[model samples]
Target: MRFFNTEGPVRPTDHYSLPPLERWDLNEILTFIEQKKYFLLHAPRQTGKTTCLLALMDHLNRTGLYRACYANIEGAQAAREDVERGMAIICSVLARSAQHYLQDSRLNNWVRADGALVPAGDRLFQLLEYWAAADARPAVLLLDEVDALVGDTLISLLRQVRAGYTQRPNGFPQTLILCGVRDLRDYRIHGSSERDPITGGSAFNIKAKSLRLDDFSAAEVRTLLLRHTAETGQVFTSEALDRVWDLTQGQPWLVNTLAYRACFELPEGRDRTRPITLALIDQAKEALILERVTHLDQLAYKLREPRVRHVIEPMLAGTALGDVPDDDIQYLLDLGLLRQGNGGLTIANPIYREVLPRTLAFTPQASLPQIYPTWLNADGSLNPTALLEAFLAFWRQHGEPLLRSAPYHEIAPHLVLMAFLHRVVNGGGTLEREYAIGMGRMDLCLRYGAVTLGMELKVWRDGAPDPLTEGLIQLDGYLAGLGLSSGWLVIFDRRADQPPMAERTASSTTVSPHGRSIELVRA
Candidate 1:
């Protein structure tokens, strides 16, 4: 009766899961622990860091090599700049964890018994020193969500750990592992009085190395899905399995959530006799996105951050990343919002690719003016010509104002257009997007009933020439990929000298170099 686990830590008995240790380099980790090196284990939220840490603690304890305990210090986040409160919370949690995990009760009442006398900065150091002295086996501490501590609280924690680094195995924890969504190097801690932010490296210079936990590989994704089949005798078609990998790119929580929805939540998928098919997988993905599930919703919330917008806006518009800082890009990569592909920085996966733009356009989509479905025929088929006309009229009257609602200014036009199209395909159709670094254009494919429409969005900047010829060539390639002879190419005029939106917005018919008919819209 094991199910795919999407929440909290994975328990093998209750959930179908890959062996946690197998996801990491066991030898490297053991080497760090044996050497008593303080280090970091980081990955995006919900990538199974807690599950892995718990398993590692059990492994170390069972081997009789160490007395290990895993404690989540995220609860200390609420203390913010209050160093004393944060330290007390952290110490008490660690004490409870030690008692539970190793039957070590020496530090159980240490927080209430002695913490008030010691300085907030020295409390953690004192607790660890006493705990290590009480055990013959070296104490291995795995602290999860270490980054959740903020400001002065975070600074005190790191400085205390650094202060006690010299006393190892005998006086302090042998191997201290900090786990969080971002590597410690990414921590920019601002203290209450400091003029400049404190880098994590300066506070905790003893870190030996940073290890990143990665998403599951394609093979691992397959193995997890097949486990459900083996247990329930409800098969997943080959295409459905591949679709899952394509959408999630092996993000652990996403894979589990999608599979859980497909197998348990969706009524059609619950039937033991019915094989999970490609269509069902797509339905599950759409449902997950529309439901605005917590995982994806948190990701969408990140788009509002200036750093995130810096990297994402240009990527969305398919423009060169001009003067973007290395740390900003690294931040997105660490958040698992972007990945380093052979093609350079790309959104992590297909599911994210769709989610980012739709999330960006959500407000504009809602603000869209009321307009009848002039683009649809009596039989509910899309009329490409009519759709273009409707869009042109919409742009003339409301597009300029709607642009104000776009998430990022650089890509406002793209967002506004997507908003209109999202309204077009609201309930019955699908909108697929293909944009990436160096692509120089965002390609979109809209499928409504029996009709498919292709589009390419380009911007005509201040110093650039009209993108008409270039867009035609690109749209021709895009249409060919979709196996269609016709599509639309939209060039938003962003040049400083351009006329007003209402006056300049217009469309014309043209033929691509490949002789495919193209509906060219210039706005």
Candidate 2:
């Protein structure tokens, strides 16, 4: 039976899939190809880019309007700065892909050309000229993972393609598509002769436009999930389906992975009579994250990059991001970590919302000592008073040391607290985080069965004033959203003159204008 595909390009006959062409602007793409334009098709990895390009190639070929072939040249990424070797591998891959897709072997014949030699830089250009001349139909070349080729090799490839642009459809490809995680404008190539990085547009100069393959829409997400129901008579509850969209926000890989896990991996999920529930969906979501699956693992690893850190640090800390570069923002977008939101940037999806904090807090959580689950009552209910006391005790003893060991300097205290809470709340509850730029404080809502305890985290920097007033106001608003009467407001004084943590840590209770009692904690 067909299943959800996460490993590679989705095959409609083998995997449940939405029509690939529906994900983007097909008319604009066709217009570019008809005009013989060299362009870029880019989006985050595993967002079904290769699948759509393959669909496009098949569409063009069936219409007999162009001879199209899709080639993944990422295999040459291993060649790195070796332009000659990289070009040779790319040419070979292109030839094989042409033969496999279009039954064309002329590229192989022209590779050697009776022992006649072309310059290393001109090899790709010469092969393209020979291939185009051999076919009466205009050839459309789709190069996947074009960004994987780095340094001088990437430069040489782009330069070679541009050099033969004027002769396209006769001596070169009629239309060329460079497909990768980043748009051509964002390419920062460090070629051997360059003292500094150069933009990809400078290297190619022939690109006409860049098109991004968008994630599936809400309706599309439902359609993909309903495939399991249609095939096996196993139903997904309305809430379960809604939760899928809510968690993934239509990221294709994530949507498919969750459905695949629920339907095929879990024994209860496989029983046709059992309807998938929202709880089950939530379980699958966390399992996917905790397993450190390939897609999520790759994304989390990007956090170590200095460029990625700058934007994410302020985001986690709820402070303003000052003087961040435009290129770094675009790079994060290209990496699929951040998406353009209503007015600014946001973590792309709810799954990412959970993934980022847990990833940052992973180490501190693991290093935690064997402390009792002191907050759990005999009836398994959460004792809020005890939980807060435990947190205070833990903070007094280990918080400072953990903060010193944190990877992100700007958000160290926040991470340590989150790590402590996550380790304490495992197996019986869920932790949800809400923070954003200029919010001045991070709000966390911990749901343990019937208990929903909210906490507000604020940092008082060296020159900043005490945050009690602003934090209480924000806490009241946050409580209103949660339909709660009270919560905790934590202010970490970072001023240089502050006494040692041992001397200053304290907690008290305060009343808001709305008559909600807030437990105020100062550390």
Per-model TM-score, in order, reads: 0.97, 0.96
Which candidate leads the pack in TM-score?
A: 1
Tens digits of lDDT, candidate 2, 135-154 = 78998999999988889789
Model 2 regions more than 4 Å off: 112-116, 191-195, 198-201
C-alpha lDDT score of every prediction, in listed order: 0.91, 0.87
Query: Each candidate: RMSD to true structure?
Result: 1.6, 2.0
| Model 2 score (lDDT) | 0.87
Q: Estimate candidate 1's RMSD in Å.
A: 1.6
Q: What does candidate 1's lDDT look like per residue over 1-523, in tens digits?
A: 9999989999999999999999999999999999999999999999999999999999998999899999999999999988888998999899889889878777877877887689998999999998888878899999999988879899889888888889998999999999999876645686653335755436777899999999999999999999999999999999999999999999999999999999999999999899999999999998998888999999999998888888898888888899998878888998999999877889999999999999999999989888899999888899988999999999998988999998789889999999999889987999999998778999999999999999999999987788888888888889999999998999999888778899999999889999998888999
Which residue pairs does candidate 2 place in steric collision? none
Position 297, candidate 2: lDDT: 90
Error of 2 at 378 (Å): 2.8
Identify the runs in model 1 with alpha carbons over 4 angstroms from their true place.
Answer: 186-188, 191-196, 199-201
